[model samples]
Structures are given as structure tokens and as C-alpha cells.
Target: MKPLKIAMMSMTHGHTRKYYQTLKDNPKLDWVAVSTANDEVKEIFLNSVDGIPCYNSELEMLDAHPEIEAVVLASENSEHLRQMKLCAERGIHILSMKIPTFDMDEYEEMIDIVDKNDLVCQVELEMHYNPVIVRMKELLANNEIGKIKSFNATNITLSPVWAFPWQGVPEKSYGKRVHVKEGDPRFRGGALCDHPHIFDMIRHMTGSDFDCIYAEVAPNIRPDIIEEDMLSVIGRMKDGTIFSLDPSWSKMEERLKVPGPGWEVFPKRMEVNITLNGEKGTVMADCFGPNVYHNGCPNDRYTVQYTYFDEWIGLIDEFVDNIRNKKQPLINLKWHKRTIEAMNAVYESIATGKVVKL
Candidate 1:
């Protein structure tokens, strides 16, 4: 099997660090060059001692490493279209970060570009690779819970503003500076924008699309932040299943320049748990839990040491297969478009204080 030559661009996303080790160690990928043009990101890559070359300009990197077949666009949401266009123009496959673009037209443009080039464009919604989620889907499919009547899910986490300030910037994170509410200082980008896993995951589990959605925002946990840190969404699926989701950055964190020890003020910095009530029984799951706990560290605070950080491994494995085998990824652009639409509906609901019909 030929290993896919992969590069990363724009190391400004929260998931940027999560892919470093996987990219380096994965057998199916040759983690080549990284281009950011950000001094801080370059310095961080230099300090990692991974020996992977870094370039200040993406064009320079591509010029030097013409063999690169794919790239992970680990940049802010606003840059997705531009970066994707560069990759598409080069006939390079792309592993896009979640929330490709809040603008539907731009999202459709991405689909067209990738389709025209016949390139494999996979969105990085890695939760589908989670072991727990895999089992959850199995149970749901097998009718272990009969029929899913309703579900409540949480894709909550601590804010990543200190580490990646782009998340707090409305224009960068949400691709616009539109206010979330008329009288509110908060903008469209925030916790809701940061967490799209639940919204995407529910669709896969139920094999249904959103029908209608109603969303509301609460006072942000951290008033200092410019975006909304807290919000909730209630909606109905096309299959008549009711759903409620909390995709908020409700957890608090210490302002850390780089995400590492002493960052999380809460015992659990991130969580993606779900409870589904079906006709026969109820199912509850923690997609990233049952981990080892420790307190003797840089912070001397209790923390969850995850047993598995292999979501990226599986994701990349599929990505490499898609490239090598000429197969479309399960979360291709067309399939993920509806997921993006559902998320946008949540924002529209908040702005209008009315239920949005998808």
C-alpha cells in the first residue's frame, strides 16, 4: 500500500494539536510539510521536535513538496473555502475541519469544486470513529431501544479562545460578524459553532434529517469573551423524533497559551454524552469517558486522562483508503451539507426566536 503524502495548513484550529501525533505515527500517511505563515504556530511546530519541515507560505510548501497528495485544512472556519480552493486547484484531496462554512452558498461551492476535480474531500467529524458511538449506532440500528422517541445530548467543552483566539472571533469562526441577537454583544460564532459533533452524530444514529429546530442562548459563562459561550437547541427530526442538544462551552478553563496541563479548571474539560429514550428502553452513553483519573500534575487538579485518542487514527485510515481506493468517504461533502444546514438553523432560530424549519 502506498502511503498518502499528507500536509497540514493553518495550525490555528483547536484540533490542530490532536492530529500531530496521529499524522506522525500513522503508517498509511507520510506527514510531510506544514504551512501556516503564523510565527506562533511555526514556533510550536519547531518546539515539537517532530522533524517535519514547516513553511511560512502554503504556496512555498506546495512548491517544495509537489508530491503531497492531500492536506488537512486545520484553519479557522472563514479560511475553509479559500484553503479548499487551493487544494482543489492542485488536485489534492482534503480533510476539512468541521463547519466548512456557515454560508450555504460557499458550502455548495466547495462541493462543486471537489466534484469537478474528482478529489476526495472528507469533513473532519471524527466522532463517527469513536468506539462508543459505533456501539451506540449498532444498538440504535438493531432496535435495542425499539424506536428513538427523543434524545438529549451534550457536546460541551471548555473554551479554546486562549489557545486559539480565532474561535472567539465571529468573522473567523462563523465566517461573519452578524450578531446572534439584536441587543446582544455576542456574535454568531461561539460554543455552538465549536461543537458540531452532536448535531452530526444524531443524524447518523437515527438515519434522519432535521425537520424543525428551536434554539435559545443563555448568558455566557465568561462574560469576557466576545461570543456566546452557552446555548441550547430543541428540534424534531424528519422521523418524528424529538431532540434537544446542549452544544455549549459551559466548562471553565484557565487562560493557557498552549493547551496542556493546568488548562482545565473543571475536572472534565470536555464531554459528549447522550441519553436516548426509545419505546422499549433508554440508552445512555459517554462517548469519551470511563478514563483514568489523576491529580498529581502541573495543576495538581483532578483531570480525566483519556484512554483513547485514536479517533484521528481511524479518520485518517478512512481518508487514506478513500484516496488510494478512489472511494468516497462516509462523511463526504454532500452528506455533511445537511448537517451544516441543521446547525445553521440553530443560529437562525436564536436570531429570530422562532422555530426554523429545515
Candidate 2:
């Protein structure tokens, strides 16, 4: 298959840095151009060694690189719809960030635009490509643990607000400035918006849609931020599997503009640990752990240096395969709509202080 000409827009997302190397190295993608949100982002991107052309406007980038067949919409949660519409207008395929938009109407509009343009729109739920999660899915499918009775998952991480401040803003992160509750000091966007993998992954594990969900928010760990940083969700799947999720920014990190060693004040900067109890037995897994430990010059603090990083490789591969072979991706917009609905239900449950039925 020919390498699909690709570009990236809005270098303001937390996942922007993670995709540079993979985009450049992937055989199926021809990393061509990038457009930044502003001069600050442009300067930062230009300083990088990738040497890709940077444009100040999406139109300019798209016009200059007319050969570009696809784009990675690496923008904030609010910017997804506009950027996606631009790509759709140009008849280009898209690989959007995880939280496309909190507004269901906009999400459906995006689906309509993509369908009208006949383009491949793949959401970046990269956990689907994680090897450990892959193994977990296999085990569950094999019924090695029998019918799943209950499971708990933690998608905890240190807040990236220092590097990506948009994450701290309610409108940009959650797509609106709705209050969490009447007297609550914080707004709707925070750790919950940043972490959606566990919510999306549970569906693949149980082969079920959300039945009902109950959620609660704890006080913020970083009190300076105006969004909720700690929260939990307990829900049941339609298939009778009950699950709990801790998708909080509980881990602490130094306010580093760029992530590197010494950024973590905690032993592990990020963790995704899952535990399951089934009728026959129980299983435990770490999606991004059990790696080599190091305490070196950067911070002199012990840290877990990650060993696996090919999730994006597989994700991009699937995107290209879907485009080239004319097959729908596993996590297409229609399939992901339910995950977004479930997440919205979490916020609704928090606001109403009652279980939300799906």
C-alpha cells in the first residue's frame, strides 16, 4: 500500500508530542506538515528536530500540502469539530483525539460530515492497541476467568495542565463551561475529561453497553486548578458485569513545560492497573507498567521507564489499513458514540447525585 500523505493540526494537545516520532517513522504515513494554534506553539514545534513545515493556519497548511490525504487533529477537545469539518470539506481522512467533543449534537454532526464526505474518521482511543489490554481481552474472550462478575480499573496520571493548560479550562477541555453542581467550586472539565480509555475499553472487554452509572467527585489534589482532579465511576454493563473506574489525576508531577525524567514527584508518574474477579478465578494487569526502574541524573528519583510505546504504531496502522482497504475501523465514530454518552452520563450522575440510566 502507498503511504498516505498526512499532516497534524493544532499542536496544543497533550498527545501531540507522543505522535511526532511515530508519525515520522511509520511506514504507512507520510508525515508532511503541521499547523500550530499560535506563535508560541509554532516556536515550540519548530525547535523540535522533526523539521516538518509549520503553518500558522490550517487553511494555509492544507493548501500548501494539497497532497495530504489525512490529518491527526491534535487539538483541544473543543477544537475537534471545527478542525474535523475543515478536513471533511477537503475530503481528507482524520485521526481525532480521544474526546472529540462533549456535545453529542456536534459529535453526530461530525459523523454526518464524515459520512457525507465518505472519509475515514478514526478516534484516538489508543488503549485499544495496548499489548497488556490486548492480553486482557484475549483472556476474557477465552473465559479463562469465567464470566466476569466485577472489575476495577485505574487510569490515574499526573495532571498535564502545566504543559497543556487547555486541559485546565472548562470550555476547551469539556466543550462547555457547565458547573459541576450548584455550589461546587469547580467546573465539569478535569481528570475525567483527560482519561477515557478505561471507559471505552470496558466495552470491548464485556461486549456490552453501559446499563447505569453512579459517579462522585472528591476535592481537588491541586487546589489551584478550577476543575475537579479526583473522581470515581461505578457502573454496570448490560451484560451484567459491574465495573469501577478511578480516572483521576492523583499522581503529582513537577510543573515541567516539557515532560521528561524528574517530572514525576511520585514513584510512578502514570499507571493503568486493572483487576478482575470472575466466576472461575481472578486476574490482575498493568497496561503500562512492570518495566525497568531507574533513578538517574534527571531527578535522582526512582521512576518506571516505560518499555512499550508501540500503541500509536498499531493505531496509525489500523487507521491507514481502514483507509486503504475501505474497511471501517474497530473504534469508528458510531461505535465510540456510546463511550462518549457513558462519559456524559458520569457528569450527569455527578450533577444530580443519582445513578444515571443509559
Candidate 3:
């Protein structure tokens, strides 16, 4: 079989570096060019890694590697549409960031572009590939939860905007700034904008759409931001399963650019703990760990050092397989719309101060 050639664009994202080892190590993929959003991010990429040529611009990189078949849009969430369109027009398949364009109309346009080009557009929700989550999925599907009547999930983490500046920007992260409610100091973007995983995961687990969603915010822990840092959403699934999800930036982190030992001030820097209450029993899961403890170099605080944390490996494998074999990706456009819809409901709920039907 021919190897699938893939490139990565906009190396400014927090997950950008995480993909490096996975891309190079994947046997089926020929990792190619990398383009940064600007000269600054380009210089940072230049200084950090090896075995990959980092280009200052996409056109320059694509001009060099015309054989490139796919690209990972590892840019800020705001850059997704423009970057994907560039790849789509070139007949290159895309692996997009977690949050695509918040505008439903633009998202629909993305589907149309892929349809017109017969291209793959897979949104990266990496938790789907986690081993623990995979096991959790299997057990839940095997009636371990005994009919999910409700789901409560948390995709809580520190605000990465300190390192990835775009996330803190209302215009870039949220696409637009709208108030959550009257007299609300916080804007509609921020942490809520950062997380759509649990929202999407609930859809995946139950195979049901959200019936309604309501959201409320608490004052941000950090000052000088138009976006929210704390919030919660409660809703009902299409199957009448009541659910609640907290995708807040509730955890505290040491201000670090390159993630390291002391990065997390909290015990867990990131978490995707799920709680499923069913007719017969309940299932609680932590996709990241049951990790071993550590207090060695970098930071002296005892930490639940994670044993397995790479989700990009499996995600890239699937991307390669879909490209080489001409199969649809698991997180394709049509499948992700409802997740976006559910997220929009949170914005709508905060807007109207009432439950938004999904």
C-alpha cells in the first residue's frame, strides 16, 4: 500500500507539539511540511524540533510538497475554516481542531466544501482514542451502566490561553463576542469555548441528540477577561436522559509555555471524568489515569504522574487509514454538527436565561 503523505499547518496550538512524535513515528504516514501562522510561531517551531521542516507560510510549504494528501490544522480554533478551505481546495483532507467554527452557517459551508471536494474533514476530539475511555465505552455498551438515565461529565482544565494567546481573545476563540446575560461581566467565550468534548462525548455514548441545554456562569477566577472561566450546563438527551456537563477552566496552573512537571498547580492538570447513572447501576470513569505518584525533578510537589496520555497516535492512525483506504473518518462533518448545536445551546441558554432546545 502507498504511504499517505500528511502535513501540519499553524503550529501555534497547544496540541501542535504533542502531534510531532506521533506524526513522525506513524509508519503509514509520510510526515511532510509544517507551516506556522506567523514569523514568531515559526521561529519557536524552528528552535524546538527536528526531522520536520517548518515553513513560515502554508503556500510556501504546499508549493514545496505538492504531494501532501492531508494536513492537521493545528492552529487556533479561529483559524480552522480558512485553513481547512485552503486544504480542501487543494484536494487535501483535513484533521481539524476540537472546536470548529462556532457559526452554524459557516460549519454547514464546511460540509459543503468537503462534499464538493470529496475530502475528509475529521474534527479532533482526542478522548475518543484514549485507552481508558475505549474501555469505558466498551463496558458502557456492554450494559455496565445498565441503561444510562443521566450523564455527568467534566472536561475541566486550566486555561491554556496563557500559553496559547488566541484562546483568551474573544474574537479569535469565540468567533464573536456576545454577552451571556445582561449585567454579566463575563462574555460568552473562554473556557466554555475551549471545551466541546463532553458535549460531543455524551452524543457519542447515548447515540442521542440534546433535547435542551441551559448554562450559568460564575465570576472568572482570573481578572481582565471578557470571557468566562467557570460555568455549567444541564440538559436532557433525545432519549430523555437528563445530563449535566461542566467544561470549565476551574483548575489552576503555573504559567508555563512548554508543558512540564510544575505546569499543574492542581493535582490533575486535566481531567475527563464521567459519571453515568443508569437504571441498575452507575459508572464513574477517569480517562487519564489511576496514575503512579511522583515528586521528583521539575516540581517537587507530589503528582499523579500519568502513565498513558497520548491520544494523537490513534487519531493520526485513523486519519492515515481513511486517507489511504478512502474511508470516512469517525469524526466527520455530519456527525459533529449536533455537538456544535449542543454547544450553541449553552450560548443560547446563557443569552435568554432559559433552556435552549437543541
Candidate 4:
């Protein structure tokens, strides 16, 4: 297979840094230039990576590297539509961040752009590519756990606001500053916006669409931020599988400008754990665990040094395959539409304090 020449844009998302090593090392890719959100982001990118030229704007990077075939849209949620439009206009394939936009209209516009351009746009739900998840899917396919009756998952992480300030802004993270509920100071974008994996994952596991959802938000751990920091969701799938999900920033972290050692105040900085009760048996899986631990660092605090399974490898590989083979990704815009709708319904449930039927 011919290697795809790729670049990255708006190096501002929390997951942007995670892609550096994968882009560099992937033999299927020819890692090209990048466009940063600002000079500070450029400096940070320069400090961490070398050789790849960084541009001040997306147009400048694209203009300079006209051979680029694809890009990783590692940008704020608000910037997704604009960036997608730019890339689609250029006939460039895109690997978009998790939450493309909370607004359904803009989401439809994004779909239109990709469909019209004949582009391969993959949503980055990296959990789908994790080895544990792959195994879990296999076991379910083999009926090792029989018919799934209940599904529970947690996609918890320390708040990334300190490292990526836009995450704390409701307008940027959620694409608007709508209140999460009437008379609530908190806005609609927070932990829920950051963690869409479980929302998407449950659908894949149950082979069912969402039937109804109920959600509630707890008091923010960091009340200074207008967006929510902690929340829980419970719902039933169309196939009658009951599910409870916690996609909260319940894990605490140090207020670091850059993510690095000692950033985690909690021993484990992030977790994606799943538990399923089936007709025959039960299965529990930790998607990100059994990691190495340490008490030596800048702060000497015990922390989890995540030895991740590098989900990006498979993710990027699939993106490349989709673009090269004229095939749709597993998490394409159309297939992921219901997942996004389900997430939007979660916020609606939080707002009304009632179960939302989807």
C-alpha cells in the first residue's frame, strides 16, 4: 500500500499530542507539516517534536504542502465545521475529533460536505480500536456471555482544561453557551463533551439503537469553570439492554499548563472500564489499566504511567485504508449520527431532569 501524506491542523485539542508519535512512526503514513492554533501551541509542538514544519494557519500549511492527502482535525469542537469545510473544499480526507459539533444543523452540514466531496472522514473514537474492546467484541460475537442484559461503562478522566483552555469554554467545547438546564450556572459542554466513547461503544456492543436516556450532573469539582465537570447517564437500548455510564472528569489533576509527569493527582489519570451482565454470565473489562505505577517525579506523588495499547495505530490505519480503498470507516458520519444524537439526548435529559426517549 502506498503511504498517505498527512498533516495535522489546530494542534489545540487534548488528543493532539497523542498523535505525534503515531504519525511519526506509522510506516503507512508520511508525516508532513502541521498548523498550530497559535504561537504558543507552535512552540509547544516544536519543543516536543522536530523536523515537521509548523505553520501559523491551515491555509498556509495546505498551501505549502499541496501534496497532503489527509489531515487530523485536532481542533476545538467549535472549529470542526469550519475546518471540515476547508478540508472538504480542498478534497482532503479528515480524521475528526470525537465531538464534531453539538449542534445537529452543523453536524448535518458536515455530513453534506464530506458526502459531496467524496471524502473519508473518520470520527476518532479510539476506544473502538483498543485491544481489550476488540476482544470483548469477539467474545460477544461468540456468545461467551450470552445475550447482554445490562451494560455499564465509565470513561472518566482528569479535566484537560488546564492544558487545553478551550475545553473549559462552553462556546468552544460545546459549540454554544447553552445552559445545561434552566437556572443552572453550568453550561452544556464539559465531561460529557470530552467523553463520547462509551456513548458510541454501547451501541456497537448491544447492536441496538438508544431507546431512552436519563442523565444527571453533580456539582463541579472545579466550580470556576462554567462547563460541567462531573455527570452520570443511564439509559435503555432498543434491544432491551439497560446501561449506566459515567463519563465524568471525576479524577483530579494538578493545574499544569502542559501535560507531563505528576499531572495526575489521582493515581490513575483516566479509565474506560466496562461491565456487562448477560443471560449466561458476566464480563468485566478495564480498557485502560494494569499500567505501571510510580512515586518518583517532579512532585513525587504516586501516579499511573499509562502503558496504553496505542489505539491510534489501528485508528490511523483504518483512516488510511478508507481513503485509499474508497471504503467507509467503522465510525463514519452517517453511522455515528445516532451516537451523536444519543449524546445530545443525554444533555437534554440532564436539562429536563427526566428520561429522554430517543
Q: TM-score of predicted model 2?
A: 0.98
What pairs collide in candidate 1?
Answer: none
Top candidate by lDDT: 4
Report the error of model 2 at residue 147, Å.
1.1
The TM-score of candidate 4 is 0.99
Q: How good is model 3 by TM-score?
A: 0.96
Provide the overall lDDT of each model, using Cα atoms, as 2-decimal numbers: 0.91, 0.91, 0.85, 0.93
User: Model 1, clash count?
Assistant: 0
Model 2 lDDT tens row, 1-358: 8999999999999888888888888888888999999887787788874678899999999999999999999999999999998998899999999998889999899999989999999999999899998899899889899988887999999999998999999999998898887799899999999998999888888888999999999989899999999999998999999999999999999999877778899878889999989999999999987789988968799887888877888898999999999888898899999999999999999999999999
How many clashing pairs in candidate 4?
A: 0
Candidate 4 backbone collisions, by pair: none
Worst-scoring 10-residue span by lDDT in model 2: 42-51
lDDT of 4 by residue, 1-358 (tens): 8899999999999999889989999999999899999988889999999999999999999999999999999999999999999998899999999998889999899999999999999999999889999999999999998999999999999999999999998899988888999999889889999999998999999999999999999999988889999999998999999999999999999999999888889988999999999999999999987899889968888888888869998999899999999999999988888988999999999999999999
- The best-first sequence of candidates by TM-score reads 4, 1, 2, 3
lDDT of 4 at 190: 90
RMSD of each: 1.0, 1.0, 1.4, 0.9
Cα lDDT of model 1 by residue, 1-358, tens digit: 9889999998888899889888988888898999985999888878874688899999999999999999999999999999999998889999999889989999989999999999999999999899999999889878898989998999999999999989989999998898998998889899988998989888887879999999999998899888999998999999999999999998899999898878889988999999999999999999988999999778899988878778998999999999999999999999989988998899899999999998
